[model samples]
Target: MKPGTSTQSALPKLVTCPTCGGDSVYAPSNPFRPFCSERCKNIDLGAWASEDFRMPTTGLPEDQKTDDEQ
Candidate 1:
């Protein structure tokens, strides 16, 4: 341990690339490190735009029936 080394300098214990799933240096302070680069981030965005990711929703009512419909 170097005298100038601060405890905060320690990198993330887990080394994993979130996007490409390749070797990556994890950091608690890094925002895009897991993605490796911005390109990966865009890929993820495209997936959502193309409906690759679907989220369930209650959705709007289709029929205008009364609340007391038997």
Candidate 2:
């Protein structure tokens, strides 16, 4: 054990930004991690807000759907 040591790991992990496909720091030091920058983060956010990213759904009507579909 050393004096004045941190519990956090010394090495930070690097990850690919989803929006820009660039390298990003996956640590607390990077506020907009996993997205590279605010622009890329916002772009991803906008996509979500605009319903561009969604889960797959069946094209059946709600009334015709079975109990499993609910």
Q: Cα RMSD to native, each candidate?
A: 6.0, 5.6
Model 1: per-residue Cα lDDT over 1-70, one tens digit each: 8797779556454566656886665665656666656787788778888998888887557775566764
User: After superposition, which runs of candidate 1 have C-alpha atoms over 4 Å from their true positions?
Assistant: 1-9, 12-15, 28-31, 55-70
**Native-referenced Cα lDDT, model 2:** 0.88
Weakest 10 consecutive residues of candidate 1 by summed lDDT: 9-18
lDDT for 7 in candidate 1 is: 92
Deviation in Å, model 2, residue 61 alpha carbon: 8.1
Q: What is residue 2's positional error in candidate 2, in angstroms?
A: 12
Supply every candidate's count of residue pairs whose N, Cα or C atoms clash at under 3 angstroms.
0, 0
Model 2, TM vs. native: 0.68
Best candidate per TM-score, number?
2
Residue 16, candidate 2: alpha-carbon lDDT: 97
